[model samples]
Target: MAGGGVAGHGASAGETKLPPLTPGPYRRRLGFVALVATFGGLLFGYDTSVINGAGGFMARPDQLDLSPLGLGVAASALVYAAVIGAFTGGRISDAWGRKRTIAVLAVMFIIGVAVVSIAPSLAVVVVGRVVLGLAVGAAAVVVPVFLAELAPYEIRGSLAGRNEMMIVTGQLVAIIMNAIIGNVWGDQYPWVWRIMFALAAIPAILLLLGVSRMPESPRWLADKGRDDEALEILESMRPPGRAKPELDDIIHTREIEKQRVSEDIGKIFHNKNLVRIILVGCGIGFFQQTTGINSILYYGSDVLEEAGFGTGGALIANIAPAAISVITALIALQMMDRVSRRKTFLVGYALVAFSHVLIGTADVVLPDGGAAKPYVLLILIVFFVGSMQLFLNIATWVTLSEIFPQKIRAFGMGLAVAVLWMTNGFLTLFFPTIIAAIGISGSFFAFAALNVIAFFFFLKNVPETKGHTLEELEEHVTDGSIFHSIGRK
Candidate 1:
């Protein structure tokens, strides 16, 4: 069973009692909220991964007419734009409310997709990609927090982690669509790519429609001093016995948050503990990209083609990793609430590093002309992608959503995720070049080395977040106790 210290700061034993588990009807409502909010994640995954299959076609002379550098620019445009979007998304959500911000992003997704689908030149496509990037980046920061705030602490991990699941699901859907379209209409060239880009609009429309009727985050409402409104929302979402006490905890945290609000953004830098926490958040985001997951997702077909598969074969084989990603993400949702976040991070990095080593070794040892090389490499890549989905990706997003104090949560998450997107952008920009410069062996070995460092970073720095209410976690963050050890009680 999950275990943690009592909620609230300086509460007596009686006041520290946990609330009852939310009843069934309320649970279903929360589930629906999660489902609606995570569409942003679905759009995020699709826009980014669609390029993976469309890229080769777009580089042809008849399409965008991209040179190698232009191809890199086209591929990395959304990611770099996401850097700005993530940086601003948090602060925007803090001021505008989570639901409103997401609604706006859904609109941006539609516009961006249309622009990309109908672009007449490389410049227009980049412009469209940048617009989509902004939506993708903002969605990454806001959606997880929205889910986290709506959920009871007992189920917050699985609930917030659903965004990550949807992300991989989006990627899986993109890869499958790309395969069917590319194989059947391989002669259609740029049109096939345009069609792939356009399908993202359906989900964006669904997101806008669904979120229109959803409740504003009670925690966000409480933070804005609309306590009665917050209470009403909470009552509808929580069991009768649990609502008031949970509201009290949120009110207490907001009370603390107000004291720091006067300092504005200054507190984030002036407070030593706040700075430490922000740095930790940024580190987690940075290291997640360094694991080379996006590099594979963005360029898997290229990698497989290099390994000897034909273009069609490579597209088909790419689906295996994406399918495993969806499967492992489902398994991860079950594990999120049950396992310690720190344990998962450590195990995930270790396995990822090990997988990289095996892939590197296989590339070196396999005979150059042998039929076994591509199959062995494919299997190892599948294992690596599975390990990432089952462990790191869900835990990373969930922790980012929950780790900061209310006063700095949005800003802190934005800054951290911005670092993540920036790192991802750099990798996306250079990975094809990196693969060209160094064979698959060198690339995998380098990632393996980086994962070793990521493992130790989590061991020393990341605290266990399982079993703690956001309010309880906030107290630990503010006081600096959360950083003193990885497995704090």
Candidate 2:
């Protein structure tokens, strides 16, 4: 209401207006907040991907003594637990405050790491993993939302997108640590995997300490009718002149939302527009996972082994794709504010689908045990990881964080990311068996087909969210006008 006209596509007359992007004196504070909150992302990455290297050692007869399926179950235990975490995390954040919820998750992370690192048996390890999974799942739902609600609209995409960048960064760190620990000490100590698992606690401790000093989400405060407190926090994040205007915008939007929809979660089903948007959010999560990125992150060492690398070689080679993910994720941060979310989704899915087909074809054409086969597949896998990180991963999380209106932001994000984690857990659980049964070529072929479907889904259903404020987007979303802007210049 107090700012300039909208500058990007999909804006029509009488839409919710946005203030200019003046971060003011407190921009440094905002940056620090983003950095601290993304520890959640890093832990998410480390906890999930560390197992890629550790799993092999854990499966040895002297260690956890796991069969292939047992290994899958063990690896996916945290993921399955995350489904419940994601489902419950949103509601918890809504009621408990985002910062407090994140702090609780940090404690959970520490407890989980401790449990897994010292476990004497697979059952105990799984119990620990389930604990970690709950933390990861909750972080997945809350961190991006916290960032989005706190960030200025102009840079919200990049700020919120930082979580994914951290996620990939955590993955890269885990891969490197796994390689070093596994190759250097694995021969003498069968339980070196515990070291890898324990390292996650450092970051978890840091996150807990950092978040304890951080402010609650201003948007959350305003929703709970604490305008003075919300405004104070917002002023620290926004320019002097812009903070009040933005608070006014948030309050006005919340009032409109309250008048239209009851606070009850079930009321969401009664509103057709909310239902459609929730489905779209879930679809975005579905497509992101269907690309099979996690399969590689979670089990790249095994994939490389399947491609022909020895154990040590596979462990070292696993770093390549993860390194590429970090590099591309940095590029994605630059693009987030400038690019159209819809276009980003479409390009990501197309490239991912193509990469899958190439990997599948290469696997078929390259003779078994040939020297070139593994290298060729590694290059293709790097390409696939790069595509997904640059386009899909950042876009998917940012969109989910920003799309839902204030009243239901937590619920919407929870349900959507629950779908995401559920899909990821499913793949992580059975990927070993799937790869054994069908081989990389067949599994990738299946992923390619799914990505193709994903590409079309984005084209038809997803709307551009490039230059709109959350409040602005809310008005269009509730009235079902957001989709009308799809394919519009």
Estimate, for each residue in 132-202, the C-alpha lDDT of model 2 and write its tens digit: 99999999999999999998888999999999999999999999999999999999998999999999999
TM-score for all predictions?
0.97, 0.97
The model with the greatest lDDT is 2
Query: Which residue runs of candidate 2 sit more than 4 Å off their true CA positions?
Result: 1-19
Provide the global lDDT of candidate 2 against the true structure. Answer: 0.91
